[model samples]
Target: MIVPPPLRFGVLGLGRAGVSMLPALRTHPHAVVAAAADLNPTARAQFTRDFEVPAYDSAEALCASPEVGVVYIATPHQFHAEHCLLAAANGKHIVVEKPLALTLADCDTIIDAVERAGVTLIVGHTASYNPTVGAARAIIRTGELGRLRLINFAAYTPFLYRPRRPEELDSASGGGILFNQTPHQVDASRLLGGGMLKSVRATAGVWDPGRRTEGACAALLQFDDGAAASLVYSGYDHFDSLEFRVSTEDERSLSLTSHGATRRALNEGARSPDEETAMLSAMGYGGPAMRSVGPGGMGMFQVELGLAIVSCERGDLRLVADGLIIYDDEGRRSLPLRYDRGVPGRGNVFDELRSAVVDGIRPIHDARWGKATLEACLAIQQSSKEDREVYLSHQVTVGD
Candidate 1:
């Protein structure tokens, strides 16, 4: 038996996503964040103080660091492509955030760069990475559920009301739930419901004139294998779907109940956008929210995404915070999924990256897969804009 040396990682853009990814990074036995880059001196200072590693203001500098074997891209949605190209150019393995890129061409460009550079690229941490979802997929693959028939996902949160950085409220700029959040629900559907999407009919609602973005959206996804997924998302924060968490409603979930608090803090607490942005930053790693960890040191990522149910021929799987609820001919059984907050024990985007870089395994969430997910999301928006059903021609099956 042989042991692989710990893989050191460099982080780009230490925002909420980057900071929040720390716990999951620590979960892997051979993975460690060795350095980071951020424009915010405050974030960099705090990161260096907490991790005791050199933090750089320039992303290139971090990528150039010899100590970093991999790059964890936690930057905003718009910067994903550029940063990925940079990391690939530096010959560093990459873990990029979801939605791959804003457009298919950008996604292709990124794909080309990484392939040419011969560096591994994994995009993820979506609901598809959820342990319960993994459990459901495993059961579905067993053919005990007959076949995947349908998927229903609903997400409602304070996403819109949260502090904005101008682009965060604009869809054209890759803001809103369309670009930022749909990848999770859509990818989950693709993962569990069979990945060959055929078409989608949808509508988007920008009810808040102040926000001027798609605060709400609903889409019906038709799959090639007769499976379908009905997805609805609302960021207005009026109602939270996490309330429907399966089994137990642990009161510890601030994400489940933070609608009012977010509104109050945004409207009354902050005097301007700068202040609100600062407030949001303060919730990232090394900030005030850093102190709040779950039973297994799960950070803010511990929040239950939403209520997701996958209907099969003989049974249905309900995804929850604790695990999954499986109802079949044998009656209902509760499957408690424990990944220790995305530790390396179970399969996920993190471990997938590790396996791809350390070993010779291909990640499920590769660039093409990400492009397929993005295709579905774009089809959803186009379907809404055209007021008709939009068909997807670029979708691929799980292994394809």
Candidate 2:
């Protein structure tokens, strides 16, 4: 009997995202969950028992396991840099959840380790793999929108009801809405921009001063091709206001937004029936406007995982090389654009993490691109804090 090689995976942090992704990882053709680690002993035990896999007390121990070929770092934003470095040092391919690292210096650390070890590192900005996002890219590529002029996107959340621990809310722990939630939008903007960032100008504020982290931020980005994007984000707002939108050179636009009773009432109260008066102020639409909206969490995960599996099997090299090309009639160049309806209650990221390992192809969330995104995040934070525009360097710096 011949024995098959298994791409054994070591998972660190069995949190919500990690737990959710386990199913997909297990389904992968060449991957198997061999070892796991988490700070939470109960979580570690539960995960290991559930999967019938070996469990380690720490990521270090899990990384040291010979059975593990890849390491999935699903820890909080603050720990991503350190986790990636440790995994790389152990010669394991890595898939880290987004934001890469909290700072440029941290990103440099992860980058250096990966390069020095010659290991693959992928950032888990799963939004980049969504089919709707893909569709948007495709549309832009077709020039149906007729030249990219301005892109406007927003992500809003009501943090009042979240279950995060006090430490998790610290800015240093990557607790801000910008650091914790902005990576998806950042990835979207970069994908749409299709070139390196030229400059970034941003203004953000923490509404409750007590929070000290950002409550709202609006950023302006200029890509090398003169394509511009205006990204707005808020963490202090109500849950009903989430939205994402894009506008084109031809005056057409696409929008997506969530709906709620308050939002609907606001819209209804905008006009006065008896006096034919504008009952609400233009700026008082409460916040940013959106076109389409619905529940979007779980569905996003499933799509993301599926793409990772596909990208891994086919090799991410081709996708990376061809990521930016979309042509139009008259032989003009254009970017890709896609629009998709949101789905609810689907399995996600963990699933893809598992499957990618099984396929023997490198995971979609590799180290190099992850390092780049982390570097971008760091640059954004620096620009925001220093009140000056920051530019992404052509050559990325990493730590070993």
Candidate 3:
């Protein structure tokens, strides 16, 4: 067998997402972390020390580096477009973290840049790579479910209570559950609903005095085929749905007893940054770690924290950690899946991205698709503010 040359990656952020992605990139057969860039001196130093890769202070410098062939943009929501443009200009294939951009216009800007540069653009929406999600998509494609009807996704997390930078608490700058969490649900819905978003109606809440952004959101999405989706999310740092389901890959269950003990510790007094990190780590919430590998292999990390159910005319599909559970007139069945490194169906996000870049095959979650997902997410906020259903036709351009 012939082995292809690895795609060299220059990571643009060393933040939480960036750090978590490192293990997957390292384990990927056709990818390598060549270098990294971050504004924080400490993060830069740590990345360089750990990965033994050169580090830069600016994204522009990293993108311009000859050693880097693919630029991974894990920067904040606001910087996504700018970083993507920078990487495109440098002639690098791009992989951007989710919520592709804070707004539709920004997403377009990145899209235009990538199209102009003639490079591949892949959005890193990890939930889309979940084995269960993949199995659901496969089952839907088989037409076993008949006509897709509704997608209901719900998540609850102690998001804000976790470590955060200041901008993470601001809504305008793209902080909050809407921008951070809803993108996963929306992207999954769009993928299974056949990718044409029609409209959205949503409501958001700011129940916490300490956090300025929306801590919770509920949205209704309408697809062009008459399919509808319901999305409910909360990040107030209280109840965790993943804990409730005991579906985390780490095998750590978040029972009420543990939740109350942790909550009591936090309520006792304000925690320093170190204390917070320690607490989060103890709860099995930290950087990525490898799970499974070959056929039936799992990725290094799992961030999904709730449940997603897709209701079809002939059956109902529920997403679980290992795979999916389906219910129909014949009763219930479970389909298990695994990650097979670089192979298409058996692989994870990195594999899909690798195929897109190396083989010139456009992934379903490419830049344009990511932009559509972003539009749906923004509409959720707009609908909540305007007190009306927001139509998506005007949000997406004709060419896109």
Top-scoring candidate (lDDT): 1
Residue lDDT tens for model 2, 273-293: 221122211111111221221
Worst 10 residues of 2 by lDDT: 312-321
TM-score of each: 0.93, 0.67, 0.86
- Quick one: RMSD of model 3? 4.4
Off by over 4 Å in 2: 1-6, 27-30, 142-146, 159-161, 242-297, 301-368, 394-400
Over 4 Å off, model 3 = 247-254, 260-305, 342-347, 394-400
Candidate 1, 1-400: lDDT as tens digits: 8888877889897777776577667666667879999988887898899889999999899999999989989888888999999999999998888879899999999989999999998887676876777788899999988988888888877788877787888899988888878788888889887688999999988998877989888889999888899998888878876566533445554455555666776788678768777777777666674443223543122232476788999988877666778998899988876665344212266677878888888778888889999999999899999999998987877782
Residue 170 CA error for candidate 3 (Å)? 1.1
Model 1 TM-score relative to the real fold = 0.93
The order of the candidates by lDDT, greatest first, is 1, 3, 2
Worst 10 residues of 1 by lDDT: 293-302
lDDT winner between 1 and 2, please give it.
1
Please provide, for model 3 over 320-383, each residue's C-alpha lDDT reduced to its tens digit, 9 standing for 90 to 100. 6566778999999877655555432223666777788777666777788888888888899999
